[model samples]
Target chain A: MKSLDFFVYLFIMAGVTYLIRVLPFVIFKGKITNTFVKSFLFYVPYAVLGAMTFPAILFSTGNYAASAAGLAVACVLAFREKSLLTVAIFACAAALIVNLIAMAIQ
Target chain B: MKYFKKGLHDGIPIALGYVSVSFTFGLQAAGYGMYWWQAVLISLTNLTSAGQFAGLDIMVRGAGFWIEMACAQLTINLRYSLMSLSLSQKADKSLRGVHRWITGFGITDEIFAVAMGSNKDVSRHYMYGLILLPIIGWTLGTLLGAVAGQVLPEVIRNSLGIAIYGMFLAIIIPPSKKNHAVLKVVIIAALMSCVFKWLPLLSNVSSGFVIIICTVAAAAVGAVFFPVKEDSQ
Candidate 1:
């Protein structure tokens, strides 16, 4: 992209991004009355993250063994309520180890 | 000054997470035919993982324009609106307009979660900390990844690409362990995603669309079936 075009694109993109974040607060100030709506909103982040993370650990690369190993490690760590850093490291380590072992066998 | 200090303290882990995630983005961009600087520039301007991923998809396809960029970014970042709204309630009652503006810029998922989850009213200083710390981490990660792309071994970089998914699992699994509702939502989402990916008619949909559909469907189901007990809200 041209320098001017790129900058202009960045400006517009930033503006729109800021608006998306800022508008809800400005418009909905003090108006979140419905209990179900509030509850749903409260849970949306966890729900959204869960949805993104699920198949990621189970079906990555269409390889069942590697993905299952990763999921198993993650579940074990999570069940222990390990720190986020520890859990992340262990899960990735599990996947990498599985892949490397598979390669060695081949 | 206080805000700056607070940002540093709360931002450390976030910064760490950003570095790890953005490094993968850097490596991917390099692999996908972007110049090193281009990858860094995207990280600097966007500073969002999902938005950057979508932007890359559009850029690689050569089908996106400024308008599409705007729409794609807005759609991916819609969750921030809710985060910020919840944050506004958590913020100090006496906060001025300027503080709101400055703090709003830092309202990321991790930062917002940390701030909202805090027991005390979130101070402007801490909010400032939330913003600056992650930016530093994210920016540095992008720069390092861009530079490392040419130097790092392929095996190492490939392994790092899987780290983001690992982080995602880290975030999901713990919450699900304690909360049965969360566990159900995750299971339902996985089943739906598998169906969409496996079914002949829907197998061709993009990953982004799969995420969107699964999230909305799972959340709607959760809302209906496990309506938050009346007193929690």
Candidate 2:
């Protein structure tokens, strides 16, 4: 893509992103009292975040074994209530070590 | 000020994670022959993960895909709309139109996790504080990686990719552990997501649609079957 075209696309992307995020804030100025809507919205965070994480994450570390090791370590650490940064760093390190050892064996 | 300071403290992990995640983005953009400044500019303007990456993919496919790119971006980012809608209820009512509007701009997954997870209502000052570090780190990391492309070893780069997903898992696990409803919702959503990935017929569905379906479906199931029961413990 040309530089100008790229910029235009960026502008559009930003606009669309802004639109999705701002519309709710602008429109819903009060609490939502309907029990169904309330419960549905309450579950949104965990569902969305959980869906975003797994399966995709398992493939992120390039090698399946390494990704699994990293994922397992991260889960164990997170379940222990490790801080976010700690869990991420330790997981990444675990993946790295696993990847390196796998390569060394080859 | 108190909320703002706490927002900053809460944002630290996210900032660190963004720096790593966007670093890969920088690498990819640079690999595509993008100018370093252009990569930084994109990062500055678009504070989204999947959208920016999907947009980059469409850009690389080279021609006759602008419309496809836009649609792809819209779909990938559609999750943010859901997140913002959820956040709307948590925002402080004292916030003005401008504050609310600005708050919407930085509603990435990590930020949303921190904001929604907060015990108190999210305020404008706190939102700004929460957004500041991640934006700076995201832009700076992109610039550093794009300009200094190829400096990092492949091993390190690939390994750091785990940090982003690890961050995501970290965000959800605590809440799910605390609440069985949250646990069920997460498990159901994950199962649905896995079905989308492994089932050939369902695997044909685009990732964006898969996420949309799983999120809404799991949440709706939770709402119907297991509404929150309030009691003083």
Candidate 3:
């Protein structure tokens, strides 16, 4: 893509993303009162992160067994209330180890 | 300054996760023949992971797809609106005016999650401090990946790909363990996500739309079936 075209596309992408993020702060300056709305908003973070993680994480490592191992390790650590950095590091390490084992088997 | 420093400290894990994820993105952008600076620019301006990848795909497809790019970003990032709305409830006086705009620009999924998980209301300085290292890590990782031009072993690269999702799990799982409502929402969302991914016709929907549909459905289920106390939220 030409430099001009890149800038245009980049601006469009950035502009749209920014607007989605900023609009709520603009429109809802005061606290919301509705029970259903509050409940829904309260759950949004977990639901979004949950949906984003599964299925996608399965394919992330490109090796199903390794990815599964990573997911399992992560779940175990997280369920144990491990810190985020510790869980993440262990998960990656699990995937790397599983991948290496699979390579040796192959 | 206390909150600012606390925010910076809390941001360390997030910054570490971003570096690995953005490095993969940088490699992809380089593969498409983008300059290192170009990849860095995208990471700087748009801190979104899935949105940036989708936008980069559309950009490479052609300049005529600016409209498509916008649509994709809007759909993929619509969750941020929900997150921002939720966060507005927790915002203190400091997160107002120009500060809102700056913080909003930095509201990636991880940042929002981290901010929401904090013990108290968010302030502008806290948000600023929270986002600082991750932004630099994201952009710097992209620059390193793009400039290095494919030297990493595939196994290590693939292993690192799971890092961000691991972080995501770390964020949600503890909360779910504490709250049955959160657990239900997470389960519902994950099952729906699987349906969207593996079902024949549904699998054809773009990832951005899938995420929106799954999140809204799951969150609505939680809202209706397990309404949280207004004060608890």
Query: B136-217, model 2: which lDDT tens digit per residue?
Result: 8899888878988777788888888888788878878887788888899999999999989999898998887788999999
- lDDT tens readout by residue for model 1, A11-83: 7666766776666544443545666676666566666566566665465523466667767776787678665
Deviation from native of the Cα of residue B48 in model 1, angstroms? 1.4
**Model 2: CA > 4 A from native:** B61-66, B229-233
Best by TM-score, which number? 3
Query: Highest lDDT: which candidate?
Result: 3
Model 3 Cα lDDT, one tens digit per residue, B63-129: 7887777788888888889889888988999899888887888888898998998878999889999
Q: State the DockQ of every prediction.
A: 0.48, 0.69, 0.82
Whole-model lDDT, model 1:
0.68
Candidate 1 has a DockQ of 0.48
**Better model by DockQ: candidate 1 vs candidate 3:** 3
- Model 2 is docked with a DockQ of 0.69
lDDT of 3 by residue, A63-103 (tens): 99999999999999999988888999999999999999988
- List candidate 1 segments past 4 Å from native: A58-67, B1-11, B30-35, B57-64, B86-96, B109-123, B203-206, B230-233
User: Can you tell me the CAPRI class of model 2?
Assistant: medium
C-alpha lDDT (0 to 100) for residue A68 of candidate 1: 71
What's the TM for model 2? Answer: 0.94
Worst lDDT window (10 residues) for model 1 chain A? Answer: A54-63
For model 1, what is the error of residue A38's alpha carbon versus the real structure, in angstroms, after optimal superposition?
A: 0.9
Q: Output the number of the DockQ-best candidate.
A: 3
- Per-residue lDDT tens digits for candidate 1, residues B107-127, read 766777666545577777777
Cα lDDT of model 2 by residue, A1-106, tens digit: 7877877777777777778778876788887877788888888888887788868888887899989999999999889888888999999999999999988999
